[model samples]
Target: MHELSITQSILDYSLSEAKKHGGVKIREIRLLLGPFSGIVPECIQMYMDLLAEGTIAQGVKIKATTLPLKVRCRDCGKESEITRRHIACPFCESLRLEILSSNDFIIDSLEVDTDGD
Candidate 1:
């Protein structure tokens, strides 16, 4: 599925970064996911576990945090967090809104073993 590709990308990026930093292994991976991104953390984890076999990222701890959808009202210019179902501006009830953060898929941080121990 799509999770497989995404997980592959993550693993590749992580491995590249670890190598750049002279890391012997990856210890942890922290992810920031958006509510509207439609990326399932569990699926990502499962795919990572499968794809990381015999790699530096094998057995790495994966932590994912889902962020709320934030939007800015065009009418009142107020930023507010809204549920995925309701995208309208909460303050002015305006349908005109600019999405601030909703479809984000970011790698927040990575813990790598650079000591080669």
Candidate 2:
């Protein structure tokens, strides 16, 4: 699955950063995933668990927060949260909308054990 590639990227980046920090072991990796990002958290976590074997990130916890889908109506300049069921603007009922969020896949923070304590 694509999640394996994505998880591999995450592992690579985390390990690189940990190496910069004197080879610290990763404790947790926090991610912010938007609803429309198309990356399933469960799948990514499973892939990470498999890929992290024998690495410094092994047994690292993967935490994710799903961001809401926020859109702005281009016609009326109104902002609203929309789900997959409804994409039309609530105020002006306009289909012309600009997505403010919902396509984000970000690694927010990494918790590392630098001192080995």
Give the alpha-carbon lDDT of every model. 0.89, 0.87
Q: Which digits, one per residue and each the tens of the lDDT, describe model 2 over residues 1-117?
A: 778888999999999988888766898999988777788888988988999989999999999998778999999999998876776898988999999875558888899888654
Q: What is the lDDT of candidate 2?
A: 0.87
Error of 2 at 15 (Å): 0.9
Pairs of residues clashing in candidate 1? none
Question: Native-vs-model 1 lDDT?
Answer: 0.89
Candidate number with greatest TM-score = 1
Worst 10 contiguous positions by lDDT, candidate 1: 96-105
